[model samples]
Target: MFHMNRIFRHSHLTPYEADYAQWCAEQGALLREGRLSDLDRENLAEEIESLGRSDKREIESRLKVLLVHLLKLQFQAKQVKEGWRSTVVEQRRRIRKLIKESPSLRSYPMQVLAEEYEYARSDAAGETGLPARVFPENCPYDIDDILDLDFYPQAVGSAGGQSDLA
Candidate 1:
C-alpha cells in the first residue's frame, strides 16, 4: 500500500516527464472534464508547436527528394530510369497534398525548396557520379516548374538547347 501510494504520488508530480502517452491521455481527460487547472499547459503548448515544425520538416524532406530526382533526369538523361520518375511524381503528390491539407503552409513550399536545394544538388551529384560542378550552384528550376506534373527539364545540348545551368 505504501509503495503504491508513493508510485501514484510520483506520477502526479511530473506526469508529462514520467510518461508521454499517459500525459497526453491525462491532458485529454482534463480538457474533457473542464479541469483546466490540472492540465499541463506548458508541455501541451510545446507539443502543439512541435507539430507545426514537424510539418515543415516533412515538406522540406519531400522537396529535397523531388529535386534530386529531377536533377538526375536532367543531368543523366541517358540513365533515366522508371524508378526516378516514380519518386519525383510521388514526392510532388505528397507535397501538394500536404499544402492542400494545411493551407496555412501555402508559403512554406518555396522557402523549404530554396533552403534544401543545395543539399539536393549535392546529393544528386553524388548519386549520379557526376562532378558537383556539373550541377548549378543555385537551383535552376523554379518552385512552380519543380511541382508541375508536365515539367521535365530537357537534357543539356539537346537540339542545341543548353541547360540554364550550362
Candidate 2:
C-alpha cells in the first residue's frame, strides 16, 4: 500500500519536469537496447504542466503510457515485476488480520488496496488472462498488463460524481 503522504508528495512534482524526466529515462533505456523510436520528441515543460491540469482520465492515460515504457526497460533488464503479484498478497493478509483483530478497511475502500498493489481495473476484475474472475484478497493484479483502458471524454467536463451517474 502506498503511504498517503508519499502519494500526495509524488503527485506534487512540477508536472512537466517530472514527465520529461520519465521520458528521458525510458527513452534512454530503449536507445541503449537498440529500439529507439524516431517519433519520440521532447515536450516543453509548460506543455507537460498543462497536461497535469487536465482531467484525471487523461492523467491516468499518460501515466499508463509512461509506465509501459518503464516496464519495457525493466523487462530488458530481466527484472521480474513481483511487487504487485507478491507484496499485494502479504499486504492484504495483514489488512485482513488487522480487520479481524480490530475492524478496519471499512473506512478504507477496496480501491485503495487495488491501487496500492498497482492493479489495473480490468485485471483486478479478471477480464484478462487471470485464472480467477475477480482479484482474491491476497492476490495482486498487475497494472502493466493493461494496454487499452478506455475513458469517456464526456465524463471530463462534468462536476457530478461519475460513479453516481453509472
Candidate 3:
C-alpha cells in the first residue's frame, strides 16, 4: 500500500513528463467533462502550434534534399543521373502533395526557396566532392522547374537549348 501511494504521489508531481500518453488521456477526459479549469491549457496550446510548425519544417527539409539532388544532376557527370533522378521525382511529388493538402502552405516553399538552396548548395558540394564554386551561387532552377516531372536540368556545357537550366 505504501509503495502504491508513493508511485501515485510521484506521478502527480510531473504527470505530463512521467507518461505523456496518460497525460493526453487525462487532458481529453477533462475536455470531454467540460472541466476547463483542470485542462492543461498552456501545454495544449504549445502542442497544437507545434503540429503546424512541424509540417513546415518537413517541407523545408525535403526542399533541401531536392535541391541537393538537382545540383548533382546539373553539375556532376551523367553516371549518377538514375539515382539522383529518382530522388528528385520523389521529393517533388511529396512537396506538391503537402502543399495541395495544406492549401495555406502553397506559397511557403517559394518563400523559403532562396534560403534553403544555400544550405542545399553546401550539401551538394559535400556530396559531389566538387568545389561549391562549380555550382551557381543562386538556385538555377526555380520551384516550377524543380517540381515539374519532365524537367531534368542540363549541364552548363550540354548540347541543349537551355544550357543554363531546364
Count of residue pairs whose backbone atoms collide, per candidate: 0, 0, 0
Every model's TM-score: 0.84, 0.20, 0.82
Model 3, poorest ten-residue lDDT window? 1-10
Ranking by lDDT: 1, 3, 2
Please list the residue runs of candidate 3 whose C-alpha ends up more than 4 Å from where it truly belongs after superposition. Answer: 1-14, 32-34, 162-166
Predicted structure with the largest TM-score when compared to the true one: 1
**Whole-model lDDT values for every prediction:** 0.82, 0.35, 0.79
Judged by TM-score relative to the true structure, which candidate is superior, 2 or 3?
A: 3
> Which digits, one per residue and each the tens of the lDDT, describe model 1 over residues 1-166?
1132222322453468797876777677666657677668999999999998998999999999999998998989888887987898899899899999899998898977767899999999899999999999999999998988768787865666544322
For candidate 3, the C-alpha RMSD (Å) to the true structure equals 5.1
lDDT of 3 at 6: 29
Return the TM-score for candidate 2, rounded to 2 decimals: 0.20
lDDT of 2: 0.35
